[model samples]
Target: MAKNPESPNPSLSESPGPSSSSARSNGAPASAADPRSARSAAAPGGGQALSPGASSKHTLSARKGQFLISPRRVPGMQAMGLQPLALNVIEDTLRSSPDIEVIDTVGPKNIIGVLADGMSESPGVLVARMTDQKATVLHQQAQGRLIVERDHPLTLGDSMPLQPMMVSWSAPTSGQSLDISVTVLGRDDAPVADAAVYLFGSMIPATGTTDARGQVNLSLFGETPQTIRGLYVKPKTDYWSFYQTDPDIRTDEPNVVGLRPLADWPALANFPQNQVYGWGQKAMRLDQLPNQYRGQGVRIAIIDSGAATSHEDLKKIRFGFDVINKKTNPDGWSDDTVSHGSHCAGIICGSDNAFGVRGFAPDAEVHACKLFPGGQFSQLIDALEYCIEKQIDVVNLSLGGAAPSEALEQQILRAKRAGIACIVAAGNSSGEVQYPASSPNVLAVAAIGRLGEFPQDSYHAQTLTQMVDANGFFSPKFTCFGPQIAVCAPGVAITSSVPGNNFAAWDGTSMATPHVTGLAALTLAHHPDFQNAFKARGPERVDRLFQIIKASSHPINLGDPSRTGFGLPDVLIAVGLQAPMGMPSGLIQRAFSGAAQPQMMSAQPGQSMMGMQTMSAGFAGPYGGFLPPYLGNLQQGLPYGYGFGRPGW
Candidate 1:
């Protein structure tokens, strides 16, 4: 009998063994004892026979209340466009049979058939009718090449008994209890209270719940140091959820885990003043450079949920399309029902007006491609095709799925072949980079946060002091990490425009992706050759762009290269400008060493004491003095000397 490709019932293996530490101490065997050992011993050759009246030698039996039909694939039918025809024959034959009702199709090849209650005493008659109909169709259209068979009844002996297994790891002890602290954070970068965190691998596994500060402390009672095999967050009714970490965490420094909420934004706060030049812009040194190229003539498309077309800051939106609704004109379809698309668009090209926040590439014309409503694989393909047809320079895809789909991958490759550069989020799952981003042709961006920076604050001071030995600036707890990461950017507590002409701070690798997209536009606008290569769809265009971005990035000293990639990108270096002196080097170490600080003369020297005081206060804390030269000297302040209030985005 042919098995269904999609519904194969592979035998289950025994559960895993217990933690290594527990197994060693208790002298337990490595494998779990088989629960079916007794039955196998009694049965001859471990082969059991079916009960009487259940089945016959020639035909398989069905359950007393239901009938099963298994459709056999016709070789070469798919190539001839006859696969749909086979399905139609099955449906029509089942519908025409007396008291026969088709329930559903199952399996990858659509081979399984479920029927409702009818002829409960005998299903052989129904099965024979289905077989005859299938044979007749094949004879008429396919020269009787195809076949159909009745599905066999599932017997008790067909499946193995499930055995429980436990995971274990070895731990060496020092005869001292280890104190460990853990902080759980939400995707928004806020503390998650009351969520349970479990610690396993030791003889006595410890567990605790996070408090108001989203922190939990654990004390291991083992005699010496031991490995922890697993650390997981127990599922709860709240908004927080967690993913298991690999190479289990040791009982050393406090661990920080980020949990994603059901919704991106749980609440909103009022927009603050001093909104221009957000930390993201400052980190890339956009404030100090000349505004000769703000992506003036670049064409970029943000393919996400949708964008707020009428928002004051998003007036530069020149074109819009709804891939989900299949609409060309903006009416009703192009509006951002979910604020994620609007936020990403704002980061890329929010208007440069004085009233609201400025975007990275303020003059770039952004096109909104809505795809979130019916985010099917086909819809994503259509969106990519649209980008190719329109010759879009840059496509900001701040969305992705956990599993890679071949159809989606083919579309991304098609876009690459047509010279469209895609910037994708590495996901917020804190694991492997998600699909599309994981695709080599696309640029995958990881998220980073300033050390000790809080989400509510307007400006995340660039305190590289703590990150001196580290590879990147911010190692956001939630951002996914892997070798596919192309670059790192500010993705934590990032403030951008929402749907209602309002501004809010959001966090995710989604937010980080647009920073690269906006910078790519600036790079292309400044270098005409790169733009020409992009338009010509040169094979080396994407590779060359990746090389340029990496070449311009500042080194982040992370233990895992997969996490930070080539560190953070500097717009100055990317656009052919001289490298800045204060690009997150050893400034913080020098400050703590009592070294002479760099000075800058203010327009009014005496009027700068307040700025100096603010800088001093920021440096005096535990996360002190790592500010770069541009932001270090508070006396010079913002372009207009806008006090020490949090710098805006």
Candidate 2:
């Protein structure tokens, strides 16, 4: 590996541009030549006890913010109150104390914060600055708040709470303890381990993941035995998340719950493993695209769990990094244990090798940044910095979170300034768009399904809504909605590569996002407007890319703009071409020989003779299903501390 990110990696097809800085361990100072390294430096004015390596784990619990204190915002300003914040006062205070590092100026006396504790004096020293300067800090007992100016306000809240740092945590020392033993079973009474079991009563559910014997032990504290109001079982893979309401149960013995299998309902049904591509490729018209426009010269990144380099279709991907393990992990970004990233990668860049599924931009350069299975906000910032340093053109964020982070917002803005277009998933919670996606700087995408594109017996039918347009396209019931959605794409029954060289069909807004990202890559690499915009690398290039996508989109009658934004962005329209006149052209595929190859456009709904895959009640794979809706890392982050709410499988 090169010591400097700027030095060419022998494996990369094209050398990365002169980066602003090299990626280093958390908070280490950068060479004077590269200033972008300042994005995450946690060096407080005076050195103290904590070392960057020493504080690495603890830093995951850090926080930051800058509040505006003006006359109108101050207490009793008209009568006899203290004056508002001034630049000189803030600077002097920041200079005199070793707790805060001044980031940038919003206005006089109003300094905007960038990231983690700047002062390395101690573990929480840098974040404590928020308390001293403007923000009100809180600890384990209650959720914290850090005032932020909303770029685009929504009806969700009057204030967006600062995700707590979770500096320290411990369970209640004294309380009425209750324990429940449960067993999870799959189709045919097979054991289901790693399945999350939540027992909902009058209080928040007591949660636990089942062990290999399909057993889980859950304990909660209260006054006495709590009534079993509901039992929800969520398996990690290939099973429908199960929910049961009010039933007879005894805490004395094992409680059993059964889950529906995600696929192979009729046994040996031909999934994408036998097909050339998934339905998404056809809906985005990727199947009909010119063979030559395979996202050549475009560099893309998947900032999710990780990509399986060993996956046959993903052999061409040569670059990746483990953000959570930058100082360690030994190039393990390619070891995708979660399989979510691999699936998304296959959708974006899988090879058209004729044996497995095809990707939208099979030839584009892909760099996977491992940030999930376990990742924090600070780690997310580092990943985007790596993107900027690597000059990545398109970023696919299949993850999401409920709370917004100012540091993340700044880092994303920095990437945009460097001309990177970030396309994110509108969540699958059937709620409003999640953060990052909700940020105005990035493009947010929702999920859409064609009426007959997937099997009716499959769970993909569960997502089918009454909002189907005249063209048979409809907004999926599980996709998050609101004004933030930039576009919609095929997210139901999306078949792509998983780990172990096998392929699986799945669904989610996570699947929908990559379609747009893959299309963005094609436009950037081949569009004339994009070619010209690259001349002067700035925010304008990003703006142009976004404009072309929206302007080229063909509207759908999904009823609400919040659900599908401008609608599905056409590949030809996006790359400065036109949709064929008169009637929709049959899939115009072409081999390397450049010969026209017409193919089936789509499947008719309810037309199949028989036997498909999966139970008719839910979605495809784990987290990929619409019922449980991959909750991202929300449960892990709790009161807002760590892990992106990845809307992924």
Candidate 3:
């Protein structure tokens, strides 16, 4: 086997070594004014530790309206009643630090802070908090320079405690079921699947998906539901609403049932308490989704950092490999110290339990291919190749980089030719969309901020439906922009399982990509025949399946260029179950234009699905269901940290 160069960190494995500076330094005179002088002076009895009279000798510099002082003298100001203004002072200092190598930042609270990787020269001093004006005055009295101008008024209102939004939920109601059957219409009354029809009563009683008909039956239950006489149902986030019409009531007939601007149910009266932004009840539309994906034979490959198979929510991660650490066990990949992989993985295929947020395809199998955390182009290629060899039907690449990789693009093309659906994140950096998401065969997804039905702002409120095109897609706040974005979904305030079976709210394109992957898995579940095409002697069937997915997408013209892509993705479209007139005519022409050609698209042409072959291309079938149960439970599977490598290689 060919050997790859080894470049693991030696500090974790080897002993100390002499510094080059020490070895090269000849007998040079040490200067008293050097910045390093403070360290030597502070050394235990090494020199004069600030003499009493000289202790107050400090200089203050002024730039614009801001005052700069030695961080060491900051404490005396605190007792004078002054407080820090910004949420993060540590971050500001590091950006201006002269001799420190900053790594990452973490704030204990909402206040700002900066983290540096190499700042041992000044240990406690590296972390600094600003003292308010009152504290500044107190410190000035203690001989430290008060940098404030005498003419400038000190604002006491600069400091205030941060109060994060808190939401609590009343116990859910049981027994009473609010059965709702919905009929969704598009250009000409065309039915749309996964349109997420939610019936939010006091609390959600029961949820079900729509069949071939765009009808969803919600079994409503909650303590508050019993108290409220009239119930109203509305599309969760976008501009849409639905209600049940009762013809028998002659007293005061409300003409519109299932229409926008619902008058009967006070919008604010029945709104649910806030949960974590995305993982909470309001964040997910699955409960409103039909259970059509249930029992489907679909396998989704989570190609990110790595999986925490041991997580209670994701214990069912049957098989996974570490491309970064090159390890076999799932444990080493989840180091909270430096990682976003585990969080991304937990969102994609987390276990569906009470403890954490449930995944879109909770039952689908997750083949974790660690390629993001300690990113390398080669690792990503290895993961793609592995998925192709294993025949993974749906490959979700949640992580992305700026410059496109031709090698990675080639692998995605291979996966597409092999009948493997590729789902990539639309890059997090908002302005430019990244590849393979930019690849034609891949489905690129964007993020959306979460909101409840209760109106916070009149213009912002009133039944916001998950529309085909909206600000939900090209979240200007995040990265990854350009025309490649295929669809948009909720990405903000998402709560998922983390390491140690705990849960926290997170955001990123990584979270958005999985929603599309799960939807693609649902497509496979409904059309088991798509997988069969890869098993046949030719690629014609697989090609047809791709055509089907293209055909099913709902074309949206929301008047916004940045937010809307190809509109929203529908499982029925990908499976050839539903065809809408709004689909791009050009795409349709290309798909059928070459229908006469025998397998115009093929992954290495000769490779055929001859018999009952094993689930090679990331297909997890012979096992009965598409995903493992642990991947479904939101409670147990979230990995804690996103670190690569174990104690040893």
Candidate 4:
């Protein structure tokens, strides 16, 4: 929650007369001889604690025929035998007294009027007449400089009084049927008209559909208090699909589910051939890995602006929520309002279809947690809590802010305690890494583009280094540098699915984050024992996973270690298809020599040199083309903060 500070003192004048300093030029400063000195001397607390609205009386002399009067009390002045003229009434008054002329008027509510310079009335006589008319003649000035003085209007203070209320509900009975009511909402929490709901794992299958209010009622029957193991919801047209296997449900409370609609993908007259770029497949070495460990049965959540569920490359989205709208389901709307989350998702588990490009973990279950538009602190915490409750294996958070939030750090810690691994972008600000990436538990990834394999049309292509260094490949101009960076990945001009059933290219550390996320999913899929180790070793499991990926990376000899972390992670080596390289053989052994050992081997010194040469040459071939600038009209900046990516110059 955001806090509001108290309002400052009002600027309006509260004194009955203007101080001598008020008549000075705008650039002049107050002097010791000013009238404020007398007011300060007479104040109750010696001026230090004087209230802005405190009132006081003072006497002063002014030139004859110069008087100030509030136009609003003109009628009262006429009754007291004093002439108070207004602009409209001047024509009428002038007919009676031809010498009188209205000089000026000021102020909003109480219009202050300066009488003519040639009037025959004396200042003393005018003041006496004003007193008799029951009108306030605040002050008199020789040059006809009229200043209005009155109490300032009342305002509601900053803080509001809050009242607490207590209520009680009937406890649910054990061994009795329970009725659960679920509500489905669209983008911005709009109600879904007709959504089908199903309840599995019961003696008899129960099903219901939402009406106009986006609600449905279902009864769960069992001998004992039954837990809903599998709840499926299929929304009407334009809505994204939802499936929650095991929900955190209490028998006593109503189970309300909010849904967001998947925005329709822009239609196209002709479909382009889905060509998987070299950076997408070669950088992670997805071609060398086997299909069996393609992230099947693993649940990975993309905590970003939601994904394009309607994308042809995305085979199925298991579950999704619009954190921005506080809904459980997509309201028939695409989650990629910024087209960032969808690009990240394409690199994670895009369907391995013939027409579109395939992802590293094509079969992994993907969940979109939309938190971009309204990326509030509490909304982020709620998204993480949703992941924990769902028992998601991995969470990819490409968003980051410069200032660290302790509450956000605690949420990441809680996710870690719940056996969930968080992978974050190291940021594209070209400075120190941003949080929650800087936090100890999450894996912070940096960006790296191939030397000669640069995207031709990309602005970063001209800034690419000529040769691949010991750090594998480097793209230094835009990537952030810091000790928190865990690894680097191909991030420049990477092509992926957009919201309109189309493929486009993007550049950012945000684009690099999902590469590591996909690899983590593959690791969990291939090594089921890692999950068991996560339960037993706690955070050490995360450390071991990080070390394995780091150790398996192809080391690059960059000038600054902070720019590239350990090195570029090779999915082939990470999943045990290829041997680990670059780092010392014994160091890799010592890092993973724990109780939860992964399948790894020490590389021979002589063979390691030959393998590095072979790998370097192989990576050099894909280093030449340019990525066309597709997002020419989109605004630059990560959804949450300033550290993501900037528009190409």
Task: Point to the candidate with the largest lDDT.
Answer: 2
Model 1 misplaced regions, further than 4 Å: 1-274, 327-333, 455-472, 531-535, 579-649
Q: What is the lDDT of residue 632 in candidate 3?
A: 29
The digit string of per-residue lDDT tens for model 2 on 278-335 reads 6677777877888899998889999988898888898999999997677668378998
Candidate order by decreasing TM-score: 2, 4, 1, 3
Per-model RMSD to reference: 22.4, 19.3, 23.9, 30.6
Question: What's the alpha carbon RMSD for model 3?
Answer: 23.9
lDDT of each: 0.54, 0.60, 0.43, 0.54
Write one digit per residue (lDDT tens) for candidate 1, span 254-319: 688876432232222123233465567778777776877798777798888788867788876868
List, residue by residue over 543-577, the lDDT tens digit for candidate 4.
66776777767655566666776667888777766
Which regions of candidate 2 are displaced past 4 Å? 1-269, 272-275, 401-407, 450-465, 500-507, 532-536, 580-649
lDDT minimum window of 10 residues, candidate 4? 614-623
Q: For model 3, how does the per-residue alpha-carbon lDDT over 106-173 read when each residue is reduced to its tens digit?
A: 12111111111111112111112222342244234423221221111111000011111231234553
Q: Ten consecutive residues with minimal summed lDDT in candidate 2?
A: 154-163
- 2 or 4, greater by lDDT: 2
Best by TM-score: 2
lDDT accuracy of residue 103 in candidate 2: 37
Question: What range of 10 consecutive residues in model 3 has the weakest lDDT sum?
Answer: 640-649
Q: Candidate 3, overall lDDT?
A: 0.43
